[model samples]
Target: MSEDNPHSSRGSASKTWLERIASLFNAEPQDISELEHIISEAANRQLIDEDTKGMLHGVLDVSNMRARDIMIPRSQMATLDIEQSISEILPTLLDNNHSRYPVVNEDKDHIEGILLVKDLLQFAFDAEAPAFHIRDLLRPAVIIPESKRVDALLKEFRQKRYHMAIVVDEYGGVSGLVTIEDILEQIVGEIEDEHDDAEDADIKKMATNVYQVSALTPLDDFNERFNTTFNEEEADTIGGIVLHAFGHMPERGESIELDGLMFKVSKANSRRLLQLQVISGKPPTATEQD
Candidate 1:
């Protein structure tokens, strides 16, 4: 009989245990927002305890964040060019640790489609063709504007049964690309695949409190591991602050000081800085030199 409604019995039993534990601790288990409404509705009814009401508010604080909250800025995206050969492109494609790469014409701004390495691998083993063109193996790339919400993007990915999107900025230039792995990393954690090189950007731990962190570490992952949580709100990665601190887009090795943190651009391209290093444990002082 319990098998038919297993969760029903389990939940009821758990609630009963919790009610007893509440009594043992001299705590009331009543919901608070309802208590507030009841007190407002009738003068005779006493409201729940203040502590319980405050605790309820804490639970309500954790709502879902937006796409912009965790998006990789357009400058940081790694893309593949269409003209590159199968033999020439394979090393780079494998090194990035990505299974699918966005195929662009001459500029990343003009994404042609998505190329799956798996398709090329089959022909590589067969030795039937002298060379395989990336265009022949690619599927039509899905393009979306930057303003689209992550919730909407996830739904679109599901509906279309696709995993990658070419993000276009307001000017119709390639903004960046977001993958299902990127979205999933936001919740569970970073997901590394076989394509990712083992020695790749894996930070070297120097000290328990002070260690070396990679410039490419996303602000999201860095915050969690270090317990910054960005004071519970801010740019999702350290990279955001570097861009903000410089007052302009930064170049490789351009160092900026903020809140006692020295973010030095360890790696950069003409478009964006690829990596930064956190220099100290203390926050920056106002008089500190740039």
Candidate 2:
């Protein structure tokens, strides 16, 4: 009776440790900020790893974000023209290297359906495959409002087994596009693959006269690349110059002529521009006849 039971002593110590751990999360978080604080505290105490804590925060961030916040703006969308022949559309498919493309009738606003790249594999590989029509191969496109919640859209994506959705404004006009991958990126971070550009050069040639320029590219670098004298004193980066010229934040698809060159906003978010598609010369315009 005098000798303490070893098992009982060990059990008592385990109970004390468990109680201490429980006390850390005992208080219910009154708000998201409070919950975030608790998550951070858990990470501090080694209850959860830093990565887990970050993912939890990302989940919270996604809950508050909407389709408009992350959707790829219409101008940057790689689409297939429904009227184009298979041979004509092949080049676009190859250049863009996207798994899916929105089949549009005449413009981005007139989406017909979705085309899966896999569906074209038979035509490419099988010599005996029957002639196919683009209309016959298209799958129905899912359309969602720009204000749709990212979390809710993600849930729908899972339930419906679809990966992409066309985002529309309140006026029922095509706004942009959102994908399940985009939503997942918010949770697990950027999901880069083999196709993703490993070296994201600030300025890179995309076509004969079109180039993709990073918004953060130094003005000096752009001047050197394009052989133009843009005053660096006004702005350090090309994006800054464009922003100054706009007098406000510009949305994707907006274009401005600078130093005789056309700079089209290709990729952007609410806060700032991310990428620009620069044309070496001013875009062609129709002449007004008297």
Candidate 3:
């Protein structure tokens, strides 16, 4: 008889338990639906925790999502007017506190180039420095089509070393913008940056039925405060709960109802949920209902 193939046996033994479990089904999932089911099963069997499962799902789904799905809508993008002076631009930059800005001419559609705030540091100390011009400090804008898949764009970003990309429509009109951070958020979750707003913002009751809840509000806290049971194992934040509900990134004005609460995406960008308008339904009572 021939000698045993030790390498083959070693390879089989090296397979992870999860991989072995998956191999019993098939070589690979036929489609996303199957893949989702596999992930669900894995979670149910305690093979992977909910958070890791959710992130793995995100990593898969992000490849199918287009730039428009996650791009910050043009209306929400902070841009610097090319005509504005340093004094005028400083406050705007400070208020928004963004590291980069798309320099524009007369209209937002007319993007000149990107501006890095770090470039302006020189002007802070020397007021008598040569006349400052936005054009002089501009970095070439990386423009991408709205149809571009995030996964492909992420590869391009890594190769090019560009952090931001201007998203354009079919007619070559400026639609919105996407950032490296936005793409990374898909794989690893939110990365708090200098652009983040007040960290202390909390859920506030507006009226009898309506309430404004910050995206950062913990799911447990939300459940306790509202007296509703939205039991979620994967999601910690209200935004994450909503994301899992939709099974994709939801746009502004999109809404979902869960466990007697109506969650409307009141304020959100392509990347993360900012605020949600939650309208409560009747609270549960101890007595049984016929």
Please provide TM-scores, in order, for all candidate models, with all chains considered together: 0.52, 0.67, 0.66
Compose the digit string of candidate 3's lDDT tens values, residues 90-156: 8678656678999999998899999999998898779798887888999999999999999999999
CA deviation > 4 Å runs, candidate 3: 1-29, 194-290
Q: Write down the lDDT of every candidate, Cα atoms only.
A: 0.59, 0.80, 0.77
Better of 1 and 3 by lDDT: 3
Instruction: Give candidate 2's error at residue 170 in angstroms.
Output: 0.9
What is candidate 2's lDDT per residue for 1-290, written digit by digit as tens? 42478888888877876665465457443477766776787789798898888787777677778898778767567898998889999888766668999999989999999999999988989999998889999999999998999989999999999999999999988988999987886676556566656333466556566777878889987786677788999999999999999888997678999888899887565546767889886332232111
Clashing pairs in 2: none
Q: After superposition, how far is residue 8 of candidate 2 from its true place, in Å?
A: 17
Error of 3 at 203 (Å): 9.9
Q: Which has the greatest lDDT?
A: 2
Q: Of 2 and 3, which scores higher on lDDT?
A: 2
